[model samples]
Target chain A: GSYTTSSQQPSKLLFRQLFEKESATYTYLLADASHPEKLALLVDPVDKTVDRDLALVKDLGLKLIYAINTHVHADHVTGTGLIKTKVPGVKSIISKASDAKADLVVEPGDKICFGDLFLEVRATPGHTLGCVTYVTGDGPSQPQPRMAFTGDALLIRGCGRTDFQGGSSQQLYKSVHSQIFTLPKDTLVYPAHDYKGFTVSTVGEEMLFNARLTKDEEAFKNIMANLNLSYPKMMDVAVPANMVCGLQEVESKPC
Target chain B: GSYTTSSQQPSKLLFRQLFEKESATYTYLLADASHPEKLALLVDPVDKTVDRDLALVKDLGLKLIYAINTHVHADHVTGTGLIKTKVPGVKSIISKASDAKADLVVEPGDKICFGDLFLEVRATPGHTLGCVTYVTGDGPSQPQPRMAFTGDALLIRGCGRTDFQGGSSQQLYKSVHSQIFTLPKDTLVYPAHDYKGFTVSTVGEEMLFNARLTKDEEAFKNIMANLNLSYPKMMDVAVPANMVCGLQEVESKPC
Candidate 1:
């Protein structure tokens, strides 16, 4: 709730918060407006909304460089593979730990550069084994980063479930503390999913207001262990589909 | 807005209106509850909602018989192929005129029978080459068929545009007048898509109040021609996927 966007925001940096209602997923689009290539990258592109995303890219005269995923999602398939077919030469990037085929295998500290800006990856696996947070500097000319795409490891006032898909409460708690909470207190946090209509949050706000994760490490682990959660409805189809970068399992295999 | 569900509805037929919010598609589940097989049929099952639909079928203790599409959709993939994989023995049904592969090819005047009720097919191709409306009697005890699934042919207040994909204003006008308007005055109409949140309408209501189709033949054609509607965002993906019973085109053939 403490999220803010300044009116004097850098003109060279373009950002948009795109939402897919079916899964309540937020896809972030960041581009360098001043770059001749109009280089753009999308984080967490959804399979169902690929056309809409592609249309927006064409409308902005931006050449998509990377279709990235924060993790192999359980709620919906990623659009990375499909985007590769639509936009020739566009690369699909994901964490090496995800064990999925992609154009680029990223690791912690890896910088995914596009145009004048780059997203610095931070390993924050808790929602899933390959979950990562992407941090980027304020603008092309700014050296200090002020925004973090926290995926599901950290949400507005809560965090992702640590019960399935290689999730660990202790690790999630530690990851949030070391990788996310340690960021600049005012840095903006854009999460992958938000069911309650929250757009963005801040490290300072989440550290103090995130009810589920603000407790001591032991208490946080206990909270996660005792929390009874329902499996997402799309898990069966989404996981397998996402494992192949959004291609249906049957389609990916030969007869 | 005029839609109504009565508690005293006939006990022999089980009916549920399943909605996929992504495409604003309404899938109708109808079953003859008193039959020993409990033969259930779905009209316009969406691809992404297959799990949800399958859950409903299992919970209802009904044996799914057919996954019927009103036409080859251009907004979202159909669940016919996926549903067949999940619910073994379920047949994919569509109009033979659609030129799409399915288990059973239907035609105008065909009767798609389940346990006790049957859906009479009426060719109403204006939105596409093989669009059809399915009309079923209220119940065994009722004398008149009072429900029609009008696909994209006859919407709540407007009909499908005659701008692309074998669409024709003249054919659409003729189909509505002869096949739809002449139905029982009280026949309830369930459209495939409704962006304004309307659930149902009556033949009597549409004839008098449907904004786009109530005019004379020439006026209706002009209305259809002047729609100037934007293409659906998912058309490219949906049409190709649907042509193969919702299988992704890339996955259907050899690498």
Candidate 2:
């Protein structure tokens, strides 16, 4: 009904970036304030910080509809299962490639909708086999701000290493070039983890400046294959817990 | 075998203070390097940082003989259970009053030993019902240095809040004056948590300058009773997990 861009209209949509200091993980909360119900969605919720996130949701008077993960993470345990436990009926969503039990297993080209807003899913599996980027729809307005939740595929100045759990430097390069960089140069890139305090970056900035990912395909693969990074500290415990969508092994068993 | 004081003989003993930034928690590692076995013990291990701790233990080539908690913590999950899963035969020790299942239930006057070094347990409840201070024994050398692991019962220039989990102002005051303040003025005090980047303090400094605990008994009680602090963010999860000595609920029981 209105020609004004919703991105500029703060009252129409709600968005927040929450950080978990322990793991340097960023959790994004997006809600459609335009809707009467204020339907909301959360991305990459850390288990230990659920109390803070939930309190925030209450304070903002938003009703969370989905808790989504870009992939099964290794650095920190997800709060997806715990959030579901806390707010009954909130859907748990993840990529089908993850093969983890989730309420909704989304694939490439899938659209997750809330009220009038939708996020177009684009599989960007370089960091992990199941990694995906959620791109916001431009809506009816021509100048609406487009955001890409890049997960670990494309970091601010670097990209996720292609050494863990089905990681492939070639595939990651293709995904970034084809799926993410193809978007508008002004599109904002938000990664799942940032250790050096960076919060957000734009596609054009990464395209010209991302030290690791912007290189030619052959060079990028060589860098990722030989970086020889150490295993993440929480990998042993976080992986198993994240596979079941962050449920403790005991909690997932039949009662 | 030698007349040199233990503190002066640095090669005979190894001590390190590890910090968990999220909680500002300090985990101390003390080893009796004089022993042929290179026996080591960790105090206040945090769950998320277990891998880091274990890596350090491996790097030092020390045999981890015990993992002890200052008390059941509310800020972070203790790594006691996780450490047990990683290293077998390492005893888990805690105060008997904590009622948490541990490999060893220690009381006042009891000692935990690693090679020739020993920690003399001193009951110092009030921060929590089961808080205890572990005072190191002085060796044969007169005027040998002694250290007290005071946990939350005494901080560098402050003390823990006496408002939750059976906390008491009067008992905290009495415990500090009778149990901790009575230690030799030169005795070093290592607290379980320090926010101001302080690594160590002496009993004399705290006795004269500890703003909260240095006051007269009645005045100390008044300060603690009116602090009115917010509940810890991790209390709900940490309390239950710590009760079973850091065992995840699922691992402890049948479904």
List model 2 lDDT by residue over A107-183, tens digit each. 99999987777788999987899999998887652114577899999987788888887888999999999999898
Q: Which stretch of 10 consecutive residues in model 2 chain B shows the poorest summed lDDT? A: B1-10
- i-RMS, each model, one decimal: 22.0, 27.0
- Per-residue lDDT tens digits for candidate 1, residues A121-202, read 9999887888999998545363232679999999977899989999999889989999999987757788998765445567
The residue pairs found clashing in candidate 1 are: none
Worst 10 residues of 1 chain A by lDDT: A1-10
Clashing pairs in 2: none
Candidate 2, A60: how far from true, in Å? 0.7
lDDT of 2 at B71: 87
